[model samples]
Target chain A: MLTGQLIAAVTTRGSGASRVIERDLLVTRNNLMVFVSGFVEPVFYLFAIDVGLGRLVGDVTGPDGGPVSYAAFAAPALLAASAMNGAVYESTFGIFFKMRWGKLYDAMLATPLTPTDVALGEIGWSQLRGLAYACAFMTVMVVMGLVASPWAVLAIPAAILMGFAFGAVGMAVATFMRSWVDLDMVNLALLPLFLFSATFYPLDVYPRSLQMLTQLSPLYHGVALIRSLTLGTIGPGLLLHVAFLAAMAVVGGIVASRRLHEQLLP
Target chain B: MVARGLTKRFGELTAVDAIDFDVHTGEVFGFLGPNGAGKTSTMRMIGAVSPLTGGTLQVLDRDPATDGAEIRARLGVVPQENTVDEELSVTDNLYIYGRYFGMPRAQVRRRIPELLEFAQLTDRADDKVTVLSGGMKRRLVIARALINTPSMVLLDEPTTGLDPQARHLVWDRLHELTRQGVTLLLTTHYMDEAEQLCDRLVVMSDATIVAEGSPRELIATYAGREVLEVRFPPGHRYAGWTGLDGIGSRREVLADRVIIYGDDAEQLTSAVTHSGVEVASMLVRRASLEDVFLRLTGRRLIE
Candidate 1:
């Protein structure tokens, strides 16, 4: 019976995702400029890190414990951070506006779509946009010769997993927000994760106790996964990062879907 | 659609008390009441979005509890608030709404122009919805509801805030849908709207149905054929005005006017005039659903 219910849930989620995609297609057709502008933020970060910060930081130790330029070390972490930023922006700000102000999900619920469908569909759209940004960032990395190994191709899927993890948790958090002012809490939580997830420097740069604390942030696992893949640092420890992200995606997705169902259905 | 002992509660507050009603295919059914009369709540239940706190509801022969999505698949809903996408153009709103029902893309494309023309919005098909007037938006919402060619449609206060011209435009489109044999269920506080559009209606007050029948039948049963309204001079107390006692079948002395309800207004007016009660002004008019509602609830419909 549980398996049957699970299958039904999956089917409705597919239906909901398709419905969202249809609406997104209409939005994209009308606002092509806004859709293209999303790629600009990460590119700006890349330029800032390569030109301004590269001169200050010089070469850093790569994931394989070898000397690599600051640009190459920072590039993959920026990709992971951009993935997190994209997913959180879409699932939190975008979903929150639609749920609270636009009342879009209210209309969708009046149809055959369930809250699970809405949650999955929104997360799917976020991942799609995140994937595009990741691909754009990776292309820039390739052009700049920042990608050091063929294993970097695997980072694309890693980026998607990172987006799923952040998107699910962001959506769950959005359900708790009451008004525009409540969004400050989201920024308060996310800015720290983005800044302190070892994105700007190696984990060793932090004190021993702070390094342990950094491991608890979801983005740290994402940053490490991408960094190792780009640096061709094949190690069994990479499995722990994958496992952490996978667990986050599953648990966060379930919590987000349940919370959305409660908020919207009620 | 059928509801048996239907009830909805928000914690300790009962929004809809136990009520029974059925909607037949190809007919316009209305729920008429003042604000907070459970009309929207009941409509939400029938739309298969709001869960029932008590009793049973069936839409399109399926229970809303487990078969909500199945029922919604064949049902259309025009929510009390406008849910039209402000960002999308007129045609895109209809197209995307149709897709929500899983309508094929080709079919939705083919249906857009017909819906636009039906809504009299062909001229504004490419314009964004935010640019449309209030009446245009109401019409577009109604058009979007019909995108799926639903078997039954639920409209919660379809013209609550529209001006007369817009309301009439919406009424005309709704009439067109009923003529095409689409079953429509709507809720409204406007007595004239109920009389103009609904073939049959139920009067709701305090979360319960007070009266139910065809509009004309409700008027005949509760208000009679004609009403005589007489306003005496200010401070002219008519507490002991036995003058109006034997003239009509029923009488209500409000602060502003004394209303006499009967089938023969002329005879009642003649009786009142001969009774020697000084009257500043008197008028007789055909009874309306407003009179029925007032008679049943002892309050004005619009107030």
Candidate 2:
């Protein structure tokens, strides 16, 4: 996992982040509704699009330019968005409350854990949640007969990668939040991405300028990568999406660690 | 712990100016000062969590700047805030905190029961921290700090917000830690708490050390042996009373009382009465660290 590499990237004392994950696991054992609830939103979107809208919309052009059912086209993008949400929700609201109210990082820093450990540990937890949502969503995809090819199996890891990118970036954003009132901006930023990042429709539906703008959304790369994998449209062009997500994850991780060290230790 | 010209600055504000001190092993050391006297800042530097702005400092024989995690591994920190995991059980907080120091699972498990007993939270081990009272939460934070079996412990205003009974209980627990030879470094503005807990203390005033020694020594060197308190009626101009001056080594005239500091309170009180000054009541009080701070800084500790 990238978490192992991230740990070595910032510190020699990386076990502290694992300890944070263990604490989160113990806390989550009480209110599993949190995870179930996060997993439900995208499923609802998937069902609404598949059952209600797919009948009216008919087939759409897939990545291979072949005609495919609307459900089939939207399913992979839904999975990618869900992965991003699972991680972002965990990193944003979760980090905000724990840092400001719970004072968990203040306690951890008093021990041997560096800010890098706390950052990666929190991201690692979100990534796990994202993975769970991805797996469950994939299972649903298979049961619904939405999975197109054997390559769809690779979507799970690709979904986790999406989670890491959004989760890291979300954490970096969360560090800048000052109060609960500041949390409204998270919704402001995420709702537009959820609606406009090629999640519900193909990028072709947009005008030329809007389509170009949509590509700038990080979630767009996530959706495109997962969609390519699930559609079995194998090509070297997919490397661009991977590079974007990876770079986002690295930059986000660095900024988050640096910002957190300033706040927690300053 | 050793600090030489340690300093801390926040933008244009200097929280802790150049100050120096040494903490001996196996003793209860205290930073005695009012709010914003640089006590917590110094404590943070010793905790290895806050970076010092200037000067040389060492904790546990290691430089905190370079070896923070390693230095922190051997140290326990009870921050001023109640930093316990409100969502977790009392025992889970301890287990997870011990794991933060990389303690083995089995060892942490074995240590938990004894620690709960030490903290007097054995019955509440499975309870949520939010359900516990503030005193119980304070005890839990203290117990959690001990999970690593640290050689040194840093407590920032440990009993600041506690009620009298809770404060006494916390003091008792600290006494036990000192008896076990854990090097405890604490901060407080309460003279009684410092007198009860600290073997040696430094009086911090305006971001610098005004005095340092044992509690008795600070009282003797700065305060003297006893205080002669002369009380009068409300709105009385007691400061204009004749024969009040030159009766003792020093004199402090408050709104309602005149305090005469001297080695012999009996003679000072007798001299005040013999000078035809009307006194409603008189009492000889033992000198305390509060008086020492007031003498050095000319401000009340709690005010």
Strongest candidate by TM-score: 2
Per-residue CA lDDT of candidate 1, range B1-303, in tens?
789999999989999999999989899999999999999999998988889998988889999999998999888889888888877999999988888888898999999999999989999999999999988988898888888889999999999899988888999889888999999999999999999999999999999999999999999899999999998887665642556677799987676788899999889889888988888888999999999999999988875
User: Native-vs-model 2 lDDT?
Assistant: 0.88
Candidates in order, interface RMSD in Å: 1.0, 0.7
Give fnat of each prediction, in order.
0.76, 0.96
10 residues in a row with least lDDT, candidate 1 chain B:
B235-244
Candidate 1 CAPRI-style tier:
medium
TM-score of candidate 1 against the unseen true structure: 0.94
How far is B11's C-alpha from truth in model 1 (Å)? 2.1
- Alpha-carbon shift of residue B92 in model 2 (angstroms): 0.4
> Model 1 RMSD to the real structure?
2.4
- Prediction 1 global C-alpha lDDT: 0.88
Q: Compute DockQ for each candidate against the true complex.
A: 0.70, 0.84
